[model samples]
Target chain A: MYEFEFVKPTTVADAVAALGEEEAQALGGGQTLIPTLKQRLAMPATLVSLTGIAEMKGVKAEGGTVTIGGGTTHGTVAKEAASAYPALAALASNIGDPAVRNRGTIGGSLANNDPSACYPAAALASGATIVTSSREIAADDYFQGMFTTALEDGEIVTAVRFPVPEKAAYIKFEQPASRFALVGVFVAKYADGVRVAVTGASEEGVFRWSEAEAALSANFSAAALEGLSVPADGMIGDLHGSKEYRAHLVGVLTKRAVAAA
Target chain B: MTKISMKVNGKEVSGEVEGRTLLVSFLRDTLGMTGTHVGCDTSQCGACVVHVDGAAVKSCTMLAMEAEGAEVATIEGQANADGTLSVVQQAFQDHHGLQCGFCTPGMVMSATALLKDNPKPSEAEIRHYLEGNICRCTGYHNIVKAILAASGQLEGAIAAE
Candidate 1:
């Protein structure tokens, strides 16, 4: 890794100020940043460590909503959130073994917006809000594209607020290498309507599968998605599976998710 | 560079490191605590797993500064000061839970944390709990057995002495 100035800020204001410096990156869990640094994929001039900022940790569940701190690890979420959000807890429990879950933060995952990530679909399906230092972004508008987000530079995601859904489930076809979703679907039904978010299949990144949503809305069953066709256009194609296969998996997994929910 | 102070293996240690210095690097290099190994630079490998505030975490993927003021426990701290192994470690030895041992430290740390949280975990529960800590050796069959045995032994020992 290239040599860079390190600043451990004690507060969010200090961290944000440090991040405003030239080419500074906010260090969360470093589950992704450290690897990127080692591979020379990212070479920032400074790193503003957020560890000292106590505000960016823990989970809170209250009247029909679950607010998780950005620094909350997957393991904590998995183990502690079963009663409030069973499907999300299950999803967190299944994330890259114990070690990854312990170190990888939810905010980092959502901020990085890895196309194959598991949390984005959950965030979207649950109608979560991306609470950043600057502004709150709705889940539908937070993820822009593959490895892209609505976050502006110097802005840090503080927390994710998920509205407790009446029913929700996440189904993932994991890639053996990265253990990330080859094709993952998160299905949720609220008083508003049913929402289906597909991740790991789109080259353009996570997008709502309106067709699957429409079908499931009519009848929340596995058979509802039997004949659905997710277009292959702009879907990610990789060694794990082809775009068409991923598209097929999305439909199938969405059905499974809905049924499971 | 940043100066970080943390307790590792019950010892308070401090270090000066670059912004990108990983917690694994600080443990392995600055402190010369080489028991924590970095198998994969990425977070995929659990070889760098260690306990941070009683939870097993991948040290390799975490910034060294993140550990400031946090309690850390590595494999070196698993055994008694008298050189006797912990029940979990003894169970691994008795059950042949390892082959290459590259993933042992991480596996042990993860199991320790799991058993701490759930004293009497079933085989299926053990497997599910350890899903994050990967071990290519022993096909994880023996590892599961060892955790079960250790769980029983630890409980017995705690009850007896």
Candidate 2:
């Protein structure tokens, strides 16, 4: 790991100011960033830690919306958000393990945007709003690709607001060794319609399964997806699973999610 | 080098470390607290697990500066002032939870954190919580028994105590 200047900012404004420095990166949870650093994958001039900002650390639920500060760790969300959003809370509780849950934040998970991560599926399926230091980005727009997001340099995510859904469920087929998803699917039923987001299996990263959404939105049952199939062309293939197997799991998990929802 | 100050093992300690210095390095090297082991540098191995602000966290995954001013606890702190082992630690010994003893510190630390939060965790819960703490020697059976015994989840073990 390369030596770099470390700065802890107490406010969003201060964080943005610190990040404005050339080649500075915002640190949240440090679960992913620190590991990446240990591998010497990135060398920045400064690290702006958002953990010190009191304002950017909380879980609030009101008016049918659940808003969580970007700095809030997965443990907090798992404990605090259960009443308001059980599915999201369940998803948070299952990430990594007790130790990982204590240090990994929702914001970090979303910002890092690992294709196998669980939060992207939830955020996209729930249509959560990601609030950055400068602007708010819809989940669809926030995720650009694997390990990528629409975040501009110096842009710090402050919080994520999830409009509570009437029904939601997440099913994860995990890579046993790492606990990351081999194929994970989140199905959310809103008043307007249903949204299905699949992760871990895609080459293009977390993507909404519009076909299953259209089917489930109309029928709102596992049986509705009886004959549906997700294409294996763009699915990720690795030691854990084949592309075709992942595609099949995606469909199976989505159906399970809808049924659970 | 960055100056970091925090409470470790109930004592306030300060040290200067590189910005890239991991919390485990600070605890093991700077403070000379060798009880915390680093089985794997990567976060997958829970041998580096410790209590930061009363929660179990992968010490290797966090920078030392990130833990500045936070209350940190490690395996060294698990023993009584008289050098007697902690309940969690004693349970492991009583149940033959460790063989190679490499993963003992992390297993004990994680178990302490678990029992602190949930005084009486079921056998299933013990297995779930031990997901991060790997015990290849005993195949996790004795380790799980130790945690369950420590948590008072096993009636026979409680009677033995």
Choose the strongest candidate by DockQ.
2
DockQ, per-model, please? 0.66, 0.83
Error of 2 at A80 (Å): 0.2
Query: lDDT tens digits, residues B1-161, model 2?
Result: 76889999899999999888889999999999998999988888799999999999999998899899999999988899999999999999999999999999899999999899889887778888888887778899889888888877778655765
Residue-level lDDT tens digits of model 1 in A104-180 = 78988998999889999999888899998878999988889999999999888889999988999999998876778
> Which residue runs does candidate 2 get wrong by more than 4 Å?
B156-161
| Model 1, residue pairs in steric clash | A97-B131, A97-B132, A98-B132, A203-A236
lDDT of 2 by residue, A64-90 (tens): 999999999999999999999999999
Q: Pick the candidate with the highest lDDT.
A: 2
Complex DockQ, candidate 1: 0.66
lDDT string for model 1 (B20-70, tens) is: 678899999999989988886677768888999987888887878778799
In Å, residue A232's CA in model 2 sits off its true spot by 0.6
